[model samples]
Target: MKLTVVGGGSTYTPELIDGFARLRDTLPIEELVLVDPAAERLELVGGLARRIFARQGHPGRIVTTSDLDAGVEGADAVLLQLRVGGQAARQQDETWPLECGCVGQETTGAGGLAKALRTVPVVLDIAERVRRTNPNAWIIDFTNPVGIVTRALLQAGHKTVGLCNVAIGFQRKFAGLLGVSPADVHLDHVGLNHLTWETGVRLGGPEGENVLPKLLAEHGEAVADDLRLPRTIVDRLGVVPSYYLRYYYAHDEVVRELRTKPSRAAEVAEMERQLLTMYSDPALDEKPELLAQRGGAYYSEAAVDLAASLLGGGGSPYQVVNTYNKGTLPFLPDDAVIEVQAAIGSNGPSPLPVPAVDPLYAGLMANVTAYEDLALEAALRGGRDRVFRALLSHPLVGQYEYADALTDQLIAHNREHLAWA
Candidate 1:
């Protein structure tokens, strides 16, 4: 069995590839291919993969190429992890929203809309290749604006699944805070990417049940300290809403008071600089083994657990993943791709239905749907008016009429990136 990593030159390339290579024993993978136009970085990661293989004395063959045609020729699975416009364009995607007096976030609002416009075309082309070169292969898309991109791929007709590190990561965080077993924590999450909410969290085996009200009693505290939500929303909703609360709460009064405002754009830039430094510095590279233990103990364990579930032997229950909504939430349209409980397997992903959602959650669903639909239009329709409507419907953007003016500015400013209306 062969697995290919498209855009394998990305920074996250080492983590995913090294993780996959570690799975060869269980999944029985035989070949690993790295595909990217950035030859220098591709060779860097390709060499690292080879070193890891030698250390383990693994039999897997490593292949590298700048040619997409040659790289994807034969593979059982392909991982899509590319940044469409690179870091510079991604900066634009993050900053444009702040310029509009809206929350500047990467995976939602006008930023997400802009990102989708640049990303969909590339993914569609990749999907076409999967159809021609590896018809039965599954494309695991890790691109930003995942919900919007996943929808566009499905609309263009392809087999794919969008992956997010939020749900499981958040769940583990909450478990540590609540002092409970991670496996005992079961939650029902609904809404689009980066805007989801946990309707109910309970503990007990299949036929039993236990709901802990005290867990959320300090909703404000949960937002402020427990879940790290912004003070603005914790002051209002009295609870933290998972999925990018930092960006949404950046301007919140309570968040400002708590002094937990979103990290400044410059701070983000610094973080990126540090990441590059660590990658290039020989002193850091000399300690390659440390990368396996890079994150905190909790996250490192969680990553291992997830990798085991996805590729390890002995079929585990299908964990919910990012896929077309179809009917995950009763309130949203069937076409929306939402992150929910799903069963994943060698075949592909199967999303689960929520059956029902709370009223507040229904409202959240509406907000997320509006944002996702408009992003789809921006990619598929490219109309300024549609983008205007999308921004108008966003909870953060709909707060004032000024948001419309901002939307117009954003649409006109980025018109070149938009698909032909």
Candidate 2:
């Protein structure tokens, strides 16, 4: 099978390459293409990718290209991990929102909306090209604002599934804590991308015994620490919220802390500088330990599993993925993309039925779903009013005044990326 990675220049690509190398038997790639516009970074990452593959004794041929069409042509799957604007734009996305007193996150709040607007158009153009080249190829999107991006891809009638590492990361962590293999742990992970909750932890398989209560009872402090939430909160909720929820549960506190610290984008930019320097070394053939601190933990495993299943290869029968709700969560619209456990195979992911959601989480999910609708509309058709409406719809920026200011800030910081602006 052939696979193409858009944005293969990203520092995160090594993680994916490592996964592809280790899981070669599962996916059996024949050709791998790395597509990116940054020729220098692409060379560094692509070289390391080849070395890693060779080091692992994988026979797949690796190629790098700046031409998106050529790179994706006739591929079995095209994985989208592109950042429309590099870390420089992300720095603005993560900083300007703070000027409006909102949490300036790359994948949530006003910043996330800015990223969505910038990313959707570019991704659609690439998807259109991919479709023209190979209509049968599956598009596995690992892009940020995944819920919005995946929605755009689906609405455009492309064969796509959004992937995230959050579920897999949680499974691995929980397994480590429980003294079990990661594969033996199953999470009742639910909600939208980034904004999700682990409603249950089943051991052995999807239908395995629920050990969540036991986990909480025995390791509440460690779990809470991982999430950066108070143990009391976890004990009270009887569920674990993804770390992203902190921006909501403690919005003001997080905003305050963000104001004090450098934007995560800035930190990542520096990290990338260091990582690229390391990638330049001809002798470094394996993924560096520093990449662990770069985030997207277990992303390689998640992407490989999703790609394998999508290609009709045997992989985990069930995994968490971002796809159409199809009434899995009765509160969400059928078209709304949600991250949940699903049976994966040749036909793609079919979300399993989820138990009734508590009003606490359901209400937030519904609110965010509405905001995402407006965000997507704003992304598709650009205008200040659309931007304002989307911001106002967000629970994080509910006030009209804040929305007005944020809309202007978003546009000002991203004018170069926003054609309408």
Candidate 3:
């Protein structure tokens, strides 16, 4: 099968290439295309990709191109991983919102909204081109603010499914703690993309025994430590909130800490510089260990599994993905995109039914869902009022004055990316 990666030049691409090489049997690829606008980075990454494939003895032909249309033409699937404004823009995304005395993150809060506004249009345009080029191809989106991006694609009538490493990351963590294989662990992972929780850690399958309580009882401290949350909070919730929750649960504290430390974007930018230097080495045939610290842990595995199932190859029958709710969480609109476990196949992911959500989590989910709705509206139909309303709706930026100031800051920092501005 022919597969195309839209941002194959990203430093993260080597991690993906390593997975493709190791898991060749799961999803046999005949031709792999790397598409990116930046020719220099693409050439460097593409060379390493070819070297990795050769070192692995994989026979797939690797191609690199700057032409999006030609790169995705007649492909079985196209993976979108582009960062519209690159890390320089991300530095802004992770910086401006903090000035409003709020958490400045690339995927949630005011910064996330800024990213959504910038990303959705570029993704939609690419999706449209992919649609026009090959209607049968599945568009696998791995962009940030996945819920919003996926929702935009769905609304545009594109065949797409969003992918994230959060669920898989949780599964692997729980499995390692439980002394079991990662495949044997299943998570009752629910909520929107980054705004999710592991309510139940089931072993075997969806209907398997829920071992979440046992896990907490035995390894609460370790789990809490990994999430950077207090053990008391984990014990009280009886669930593991995603690390992203810290931005909400400890907003002021996180803001204080963020103000003290260098932005994550700056750190990643430096790492990319180092990684690119590593990638250019002719003798380096594998993904470097430093890539692990670069984040997106297990992303390659998640992508391979999702792609295998979507492409009609035999992969795990069930997995966590971001797709239309379709009433899976009765509280959410059927059109809302949610991250949940689902049965995967060529027909696309049908989100598995989730048990009744706790009002604690459900209320937050509903609130964020509304904010996402408004965020998407702002993304599609640009206006300062829409941006203001969306920020006001967000739990993180509920105060009208804060929302008002944040809107201007978001617009100012992102004027180059926002055509409306």
Candidate 4:
């Protein structure tokens, strides 16, 4: 099978390449295309990709191109990982929202809405091209604001599934703590993308015994520490929430802490600069250790598993993915996209049934689902009003004053990317 990565020039590409090279039997790729407009970055990443494949003795041919259509043509799948305006835009996304005394994150709050507005249109255009060139191809989106982007793709009638490393990362973490294989730890992962909770951890299968409470009893402090939350909170909640939840659960504290530190985007920019330099070394045949600090840990593994299953390649049957809810959550609209465990196959993901949700978590999920509804509207039909409304509805920016000021800041910082700005 052939696969295309649209943002193959990104510093994250090498990590993905390493996975493909290592997991060739999972998703046997015959042709792997790296598509990016940034020629210099693409060459650096592409060279490393080829070397990784060769070093692993994978027989697949690696190709690099700037043309999106040409790159996706006749491919089995097209993976979207592009940043519409690069790290410079992300820097603005991460900083501007902080000016409103809110969380400055790339995937939620005002910053996430900005990303959604700027990203949806570009991704839609790419999806259309893929539809035209390779109608049968599955579009796996690894882009930020994945819920909004994946909703856009699905609404436009593209064959797509959204992938996030959060579930896989949790799976690996929980496995390590339980002293079991990652494959054996099944998370009762529920909620929307980025805003999710591990309600239960089962071993063997979905019907297997729930060991979440056991994990908490033994490793609550460590788990809470990793999340930067107090152990008491984890013990009280009785569920492990996504780290992204910190932006919501501790918005004010996070904002205060964020002000004291450099923006993550800035740090990542420097890391990318250093990573690209390392990538240029002809002797470097593997993904550099520094890439681990660059984030998206286990992203490649998640991508491989999802793509393999989507192509009927005998991948893990059950995995966590973002797809149409179809009533998985009674509180959410049927069309709303939710992240949860699902049975994966060529037809796409079928969300597994979930038990009744506690109102505390369900209420937040419902609130964010509404915000995403408006955020998607802002993204699809560009307007200042739509943008303002989306911000106003967000739990993070519910106040009109903050929403008003944030709307302006978002527009001002992203005017070039927003058509209606």
Candidate 5:
């Protein structure tokens, strides 16, 4: 069996390769293919993969290339981890939405729409390559805004699965806080990526009721610690939330009481200022990197865990990831990407059926749908109308009367970043 990783030249590629390498015992794959646009980046990853194989004394083939069609040929699984347009593009995603009176966070609001518009086309192109080159392969997409990208692929009739570690990572942390092994915790997680809530968490050795409330009451902070969510946000959200809580809590009322609100307009202005100054000031380019160098532990674990689960090495239970819910989720459309529990094997992921979601969850689902639909329309149609509709439908926008002014300013603020002709 062959496994191929697209966008193998990314800053995160080394860790992704390490993820697969760490699972060498369970998945005895014949070859590892790394495909990217830049030969220099591919060479770096190729060298690393070669060294990993040599250290392990494995004779498996490690092929690195720039050709998409050739890279996915005869593949059993293909992992998509590309960052289309990179940091400069992410800046646009972060700043442009705030200019129009919406949250400018990259994974939410107009910011996410901007990201989806830039990402979907490239991801779909690779999906097409996978279709042609590896007809039976299961596309494991780890791309950001995964819900959006996965929907696009499904719409195009491709066999694909979106994978996000958010739910699994958070749940594992919650289990640790309760002094229970992750293998013993069964939780019901629903909603879109980033905007999710756990309805229940069952504890004890496979035959017990939920112990989450007891744990949360006794050791909240310790439980929250493992969640990786900001402490300030968790303090307000009233639950062990995910790191992406910043985006979801940005719309929560209790959170607003806890944190000072920043003017979207001001933030947008500041981002534009910083971006301009950074680009024009040559000194900014010469500044030393501030982050301390460290081993790639977090980055490497995700893909390795996933690959292990896929190969059914008795790794942790398959955390059902990006899949639609027909009857599985009452709050969302059956087709919406809802991360639930599932079983993973060499054949791929199989989602578990879930009970109906709570009524409150329906509202959250509706609010997210507004943004998701707007994003899809803007990406496929490329116009101000869809973007405008998105802002109007936003849950927070309805609470404020400045929708028109916000929309106009955002359209103009994001004009350059937007691809509309």
Candidate 6:
């Protein structure tokens, strides 16, 4: 099979390469193409990718290029991980929102809306190119603001599925805590991308017995610590919220904390510099340990699993992915993209039936889904009023005063990326 990575220059590429090398038998790739505009970073990442493949004795041929059409032509699948604007833009996304007393984050709140606007158009253009070159190819998006981006792709009629590492990361962590293999853990992971909760943790497989209560009883403190939430909150909810929920559950506190620290994008920029330096070394054959700190934990495993299943290779039948709700959650619109456990195959993901949602989670999910509708509109058809309306719809910046201020700040910080600005 052939595969193309649209942003192969990313520092995260090595982790993906490492997974492909180790899981070669699961998804036997013959040709792998790395497509990116940043030639220098692409070269560094591509060299490391080749070394990792060779070190693992995988026979796949690796290719790198700046031409998107040439890179995607006749590919079996195209993976989108591109950042429309690099870390500098992300720094602005993470900092400017804090000025409005909202949590500064890349994939939530006003910052997330900015990323959606900047990313959706570029991704659609790339998807259109992919569709023209290879209509049968599947598009797997790993980009931020995945729900909004994936919605745009689907609305444009592209064959696509959105992938995120959050579910896999939680599975691995839960398995480690339960003294079981990662594959033996299954999560009732529900909600939208980034904004999700682990409602159930089943051991052995998707049909396995629930062990979430046991886990909470024994390791609630560790779980709470990982989420940066208080243990009492976990016990009260009886469900583990993704770390992103902190921006909602403790907005003011997080805003205060964000103001005291450097932007995550800035820290990542430095880390990328160091990682690129490592990738440049000819002797480095394996993914560096520092890449773990760079984030996207277990992304390689998730990508390989999803790709394998999508290509009809024998892999996990059920996994968490972002796809149309199709009434999985009665509260959400059928077209709304949600992250949940789904059966995967050559036909793509079919979301399994979600159990009735508690009003607590349902209310928030519904609120965000509405905000997402407006955010997507702003992304597709640009205007200051559209942007302002999207910001006002967000639960994080619901007040007219904060929404007005945030809308102005978001536009000012991202004028270059916004066509209508």
Candidate 5: misplaced stretches above 4 Å?
A: 204-208, 224-239, 251-317, 345-348, 396-420
lDDT of 4: 0.94
Model 5 TM-score on a 0 to 1 scale: 0.79
User: Model 2 residue 186 lDDT?
Assistant: 92
Worst 10 residues of 3 by lDDT: 93-102
Residue lDDT tens for model 2, 1-421? 9999999999999999999999999999999999999999999999999999999999999999999989999899999998988999899888888887899999899999999999999999999999999999999999999999999999999999999999998998999999999999999999999999999999887789999999999999999998888999999999999999999999999999999988898899999999999999999999999999999999999999999999999689999999999989988899999999999988899999899999999999999999999999999999999999999999999999999999989998889988899
For candidate 2, what is the lDDT?
Answer: 0.94
Q: Give the Cα-based TM-score of candidate 1 against the true structure.
A: 0.82
Q: Name the TM-score of candidate 6.
A: 0.99
lDDT of 5: 0.64
TM-scores for every predicted model: 0.82, 0.99, 0.99, 0.99, 0.79, 0.99
Q: What is the RMSD, in Å, between candidate 6 and the native fold over all Cα?
A: 0.7
User: Model 1, range 17-39, lDDT digits (tens) per residue?
Assistant: 55555655555558878899988
Number of residue pairs clashing in candidate 6, backbone atoms closer than 3 angstroms, sequence gap of 3 or more or interchain: 0
How much lDDT does each candidate structure score? 0.64, 0.94, 0.94, 0.94, 0.64, 0.94
At residue 344, give the lDDT of candidate 3: 95
The residue pairs found clashing in candidate 2 are none
Q: Candidate 5: lDDT of 288? A: 16
How far residue 84's Cα lies from its native spot in candidate 6, in Å, is: 1.2
Measured with C-alpha atoms, the lDDT of residue 272 in candidate 4 is: 94
Q: Per-residue lDDT for 221-273 in model 5, tens only?
A: 67566554555545544445555554555444323432356534344445434
